[model samples]
Target chain A: MSRALDRTGIWIGWAFFADLANALALTFGYMFSRPVTMQYPDKEKWLPYSRYRGHHFLKRDDEGEIKCVACELCARICPCYCIEVIPYEDEKGNRHPAKFEIDMARCLFCGLCEDACPADAIALGQQYEFSSFSSRDLVIGRDDLLGKPGKAATGGGVVSARLNTEQDVLVETSEPQGYNWWRNIRRT
Target chain B: MELVVALGLIVFKVALLIAILLLLPLPLTWLERKVAGHMQQRMGPMRVGWHGLLQPVADGIKLLTKEDHIPAEADRFLFKLAPILALAPPFVVFVAVPFGESVSVLGTEITLYVSNMNVALLFVFAVIGIEVYGVIFGGWAANSKYAVLGSLRTCAQMISYEIPMGFAVIGVVMLAQSMSLLEIVRAQADVWNIVYQPVGFFVFFVAGLAESQRIPFDLAEAEGDLGAGFHTEYSGIRFAFFMVSEYAIMLLTSVLAVILFFGGWNGVLVPLPPLLWFVLKVAFFVYVFIWFRFTFPRYRYDQLMAIGWKVLLPLSMANIIITGVAFL
Candidate 1:
């Protein structure tokens, strides 16, 4: 009678307990599976997609002369009313801004200003760091935005230079980095 | 002089046990984070010390230095007492826990546990139950909606699962014919209680998970929706106290499982010391709990209740009946 009872108990456990056991086994297998988190800044900075909109910077020609004509097309088209421009014309007929400023605190980052600019002169740069402790500091001028792509700046910084290709050179969120990139991080 | 020496030994044992229990959470937190990190194939807490071994020390210092804030609307008295209530009971439960058989030192015999009451299991259950009051008081005192809801869930969850947990223990009690934890371990000399009471162990495991407010049953820690649940108002040392209670409770559950089922300190095959075997077994279960935390998603509130009341309670009742009849 006791043997029969024991058999029934085993059958009950076998039928009912298999699913929980199966789940545990499956997850235990994944204990050795690859972690997808790419440690940013300390490791690989996620380079934004080409044509990715970030902080703005003024363009320069070959002689390092500022390319902005002070036509104020970007300032006019800005949706957030964050841009301020004071046009200046040099004695030699060179056109530039006397005091050009964009309050990044208020700016929408819509990339519309990039589209409005003539020949992409006041185009948005690949720099991502725009935060400042004070609102006064956030109102960036033309000089502050020139040739600076923040600290993660390596070729074109966090933003890609060229448009994205079929085989993505820039690591997009869609792909998991299954390489030995983490090994390069020197143990502190 | 003899009486004084005996009194001194008791005091020494109590102090040592308290110190060990208090310090245990540091290693446990480190182990938990490492387990979680590795289970997901990442290194957790590697910055502070070697493999994040000193991470808990860094965290303790950080928590200690933080600003202590109490909301203006909160009940000041209950808010102060809540974390204490939560933390103290788990330690109190330790007084009755049978670590192993006695050891002789300097010609004086010293038992491992502080006290081994004949009804130690009952004492453990009864005292540990008081831990919920801490949750309730903390939630009610916070004067926040999330805190209250979190506390209510913890209360209902504990009350519901406590029944099945009781039944699970009853099966072991019936099999061993004793309520003492040490006696229960002694009963499982030749064969572990797991072989005879598999269903009891299953029920106990499920209910213990709920009791500790762990994953799948940790609907109370509704970080997703309830914004840290009952601890939304807590910060710094106050929060640390609650965390200490949580780790202690997890340890307590692991210890119980070892004593009740796995033949406490009974070595198998390898001739390792009994204390080492016992510690290894407890460590294994602790890892299993951490494994479960990462492995399973939190059950919905309704699902948690359903499992507690509809599933485990009935299952444990059946287990009790079967164990009784089989033994007879």
Candidate 2:
């Protein structure tokens, strides 16, 4: 933003002082400013807001059991045909999935499955970090998708959390982290 | 017996100076990275050792342990010697750099400096000028085109800037009426040379930046282009030597500026030890040099030439004339 061939004494003094002052001010300003990087699984784990369609989580009743009625509405609505469900009746007349399978590799992470669930049992929850080693791991079964992993999927927008190393989960702290990228990505 | 003791003292001083010079680059590396990081609104280096305090030491260890790689077509002899040549002059330059006046220890006086010849200022400049050969040799020895170009740029840049850098100090020399750096400091006991020769100080600093191959004027080893410049083919300890010498040159510039313009060992406000004042002033000047690295952009080759010859050269020349007229 400066010029060359300015041999005037006044120009030298003004340019030098002005530039120095500007640089010093900026340097000091940034020096004290906070960095906008997420530590992630080191110091703080990110908690995606509600309505985020990350990994699938089966909704639970008050007693913390699956709310799925084996209605097969989610299987019918899935665009990718990634879900499979087999219906059976309990002695109490409650309906449940005898064989439920989801091929995560083929799933598009669309919220249609959550919307079509009449029982409000199946949902694409905000549990994003579910990456595993092999193709077999991508094909999750009832045991894999049952209990909601990590923190309770109930926070909004953005949250920071202390890492729970032993169970490999996030312990949400009271600090109240702020930033939002919820549903920023959409599947056409 | 007396002569033996005198010779022993000289050897002891040389040993001490070398140790200090070798260790100087450790904290300097940490400071430069830390400053650059903070200015850019990021944590600089925190992993290695608390804010990367042990980073340079770790770097030195890495360099030391790395395989010594040499290009197949390179001049092997010159390649080995270049780093030593580059490294020795800055070490030698310290001979004339007076840290403080003689301090007595148990009835025996020991000078803070290794040696102080009457022509100490001249000696310092002349020795520093020789470091260009080290850089030139490094580039030429590598037998690479980019290395050659980098070396040539270094040679030309130093030659052009050296004139102004040398002349900038003439104002201080004239005002002090002595070429000895110690005497120059003594002359500025009450009033610093910076008051009389602001232009000279400016010229000296700018030219010194160029001389040291610091960031703004660091065309020789410009990391962006030319594949790391002259020391491109160099690796391990040899490359580390070049790096250390560069830091040493920057340190020398700060030390010289303090001795010449800012009044070395002369405290302003509070009463403190002379060495402390000298160190504190030198530290401030060194920080300014690092500040310039992060603050300003690198100059284009032609722009570098223009600044060196057109602006600084003439400014320093005019400074000399003005100082002469004022003296007369």
Candidate 3:
């Protein structure tokens, strides 16, 4: 009897019992519960932190002059070699890079160029929107790199004493985390 | 008027069940990802709407907008047909499942299921057994040699594992003495099947995992060997259907496991309702399946077959014989 019962039990569970349990459970459990789904697109989300890493631009002095002194340090330290500088002599005989370019497409945003700059003129801004249809649009030039200093430009050749401070230099050109493309893609 | 009301209720219940089953797969997909992430010391999908809850929706939208691809030499008809076949069985099997007991609706005693079948157990098995056709067709229709071999391997593995799967349930039927799922659940009210047939329960669980083609036994879709396995050639909504169906089957198997051995909504007399118990049980099994999927690596194809044929089959047989002796 025990042997028969065991055989019957195994047979029943395999062939019958399992399905029976499911059938009963599902049959009785069919109360329609509302699905929990949050509709998106109509809802805008707040990001956890600021995430943009476009190109870095330096602040100029009050004399409407370029802060970069044609020192090949930024170009030399750049890992991607995306930055290009062309030095020229102005009528005043001051030697400065006539053309400075930082290719946003190739930049890794390692911040090495900023760290390498002895003059403390260049910095990575928070502006992340750097989208462009072509490569040329992403190539930031010297004029673009030389962001607006915190104060409006006064008379020429003033050599204002306020330009000596680090914070003053940053305030002059900083524009609320200027354009950065690297930070946008890397933000999880 | 009564007849019209009854027909309307049936249609409503059928639609309701299908909607629930179809939508449940989406959450299960998210849960699987999150659970896998936690196990691997990573936060899974925390960015999308609140703990990555909306990740599946984002995924759905992304796939829909992406380009659809089809192989040049593939059987377009069969390739298209495969995901449909894969997705349909689990939905069909849900028809006979009882979530709660018969309740009076509109003065008519209506069953909750889409259809009531006397041989519901065999029907579920047969339907689940036919799941192989989806994988085989997916692999074969892709027109790649890897696809063919993967499908063949899936067939063999499925067949091997199903032997033990069938054997495990035989024990339950022996105790319940009825093929009607409702009756089996009622039979287990006093004594749960798991207490009486522990060995059979283990066999069934293992077999269930293999049947669902989950991890360890997931060689059929092993990316290294088969390049996305059987559905490699499929893209766009076709791929989405394949994914949705895979998760649906997992839910089906987990639900089946709960009902078969875990008492199926009969554990405690709670004030809430019987359906709550049923849902909780199914949820536990669902999480367990996800846990197992994320914890283990895929088993080798040969080892997978050997485990099914040599290990599970023999153990299942012994379980039956031993239980038979004990009852005698």
Candidate 4:
């Protein structure tokens, strides 16, 4: 009975007061502290890393020619079988893709296709904002892939061509530097 | 002519109070989500309007448009009546709550509350008691084992907690020497009741939380175990009504706490109006309620019962004795 009384006294007197004090202190501390939320869209769009895999794109040379030589390697390496490339000989007898399509719905944003490309002609761009209404709208074509402005575009083109020796050309152009494209997309 | 005028004034006050009660929950729901989000390092519900201010409006429209379903084997009448039963009591209780001291308008003194009865405290308690019936009916009528169990637990919890709650209020009533809510507020003019009756305040706060079925006492709607508990079968506007009533009850409890302990409308040399001070105090308590919801984990069913019966009951009883002896 004495032990029970002791327990009750401790609980009613010490435990209750201590818990209330702790709760009040923690609440006041949090109330004055800065919220960790970034408040996306209203404040500023949060950007992921530059190497973040997003949309697929076909690259262009310094002369603005399609760099894809219809290698069929990207389509072969694609796990989702989303990429379709048909190579045809140009008037200059140079190999170029006549029909290149990437079904964004099927594309897993995996960088395997980007890694397997011998010519560095295809890449997963940093532009993740590709939400579309229709499934057909998500299927990106060769023209749309090439339509991105050369200077602003990053990832989906020949940033580094292994076979072409356009390393000097790649250096001359301002390489898409930081992970700032996400913020840019939000404003527009 | 005088009787007609008095009736018209009463109708106007009731209408105004009802409008405020109905509209208050929208912003409060938004605030709850915002507080919860900020505390957890996320911006919650920021698409509809500036920082998702219009989220509750959109939610209301969505609920209204959605299909309302009833279980096939459920008791139809009770199921339909349960939401109204749940939603009405909190508003009824609000009529007794004095928002501010009497103020002169158009050369006549008018009280800010809808109505102030001599036994306002008893009226508030009586109306609040009716609220649990709604939950019980909702759970029972659903004809599900989980729903029945949820309702049973709620019934047990509310009843047990109400004892300590009543005893705590009795301590306040003893100090004030009156049951009227306004009288209780006036009694605290010199110093707030919290300074004198700290234990009573603690018991009252905990019991009030249990009565409202908030976190740490939300076994009635323990979603993990009971799948939305009593309201599992309810959907659409009916569900919205349940949610709105819960928030209203929360608001009412905070207001009552302010009146009982913190000296309602009493402030230290503030330039603001008394009504504003009252509102600010109530808002602080409301924010604290949301903070507590996020801070504490739900109590176990058995532990909740033990706290109510063992700790709060005896503590409140002792507090009443202490207050009586001290006053003597």
The candidate scoring highest on lDDT is 2
* DockQ list for all candidates: 0.35, 0.45, 0.05, 0.29
- Which model, 2 or 3, shows the larger lDDT? 2
lDDT of 1 by residue, A14-53 (tens): 7786657877887677666666556543334565544556
Can you tell me the CAPRI class of model 2?
acceptable
Model 4 per-residue lDDT tens digits across residues B1-328? 9899778887998999999989999999999988887665456788788889999999999998999999999999999999999999998999899988789989977788777788999999999999999999999999989889998999999999988999998889998999888988888888998998889999999998998889879998998898787888899999998998999999998999999999998886766888998999999989988888877789999999999999999999999899889889
What C-alpha lDDT, on a 0 to 100 scale, does residue A78 get in candidate 1? 90
For B1-328, candidate 2 gives per-residue lDDT tens digits of 9899878988998899899889989999899988888777656776577767988889889999999999999999999999999999999999888999989988999888877789998999899889989989999999999999899999999999999999999999999999999999999999998999999999999999999998789998788888888899999999999989998899999999999999999989899999999999999988988888888788999999999999999999999999999999
Per-residue accuracy of model 2 over A49-120 as CA lDDT, tens digit each:
444567787767898667899999898999999999998898888889987899998899878988898888
Best by DockQ: 2
Listed per model in order, the count of residue pairs whose N, CA or C atoms clash below 3 Å is 0, 0, 60, 1
**Model 1 lDDT, residue A79, Cα:** 88
Ranking, TM-score, top scorer first: 4, 2, 1, 3
* lDDT tens digits by residue: candidate 3, B1-328: 9889778888898899889977887798888877666554445676678888999999989888878887889888888888888888888888877776766757867665666678888999888777788888888888988878778888888888888998988888878888777778888898899999888988899888888888868877888777777777778888888888788778887778877887777866565566788889899888777766665568887788788888888988998888778768
Cα lDDT of model 1 by residue, B1-328, tens digit: 9999878888898898889988998999998888788667676887677768999999899999998788899999999999999999999998899888989989878888878789999999999999999999999999999999999999999889888998898988997899999899999988998998888998898899999989978888878878687877999999999999999999999999999989999888898888899999999998889889988889998898888888898899999888878888
Model 1 TM-score on a 0 to 1 scale: 0.78
Model 1 DockQ class: acceptable
Best model number under TM-score: 4
Which parts of model 1 have CA positions greater than 4 angstroms off?
A: A1-15, A43-46, A85-92, A149-154, A158-188, B33-55, B58-82, B102-110, B132-153, B219-239, B297-306
lDDT of 4 by residue, A1-188 (tens): 99999889879877656775676566555554455555433343433455666666777899989999999988998999999999899999999999999999988888888899888888766555667779999888899987642323442332332233312432222334543433422110
What candidate 3 keeps of the native contacts, as a fraction, is 0.00
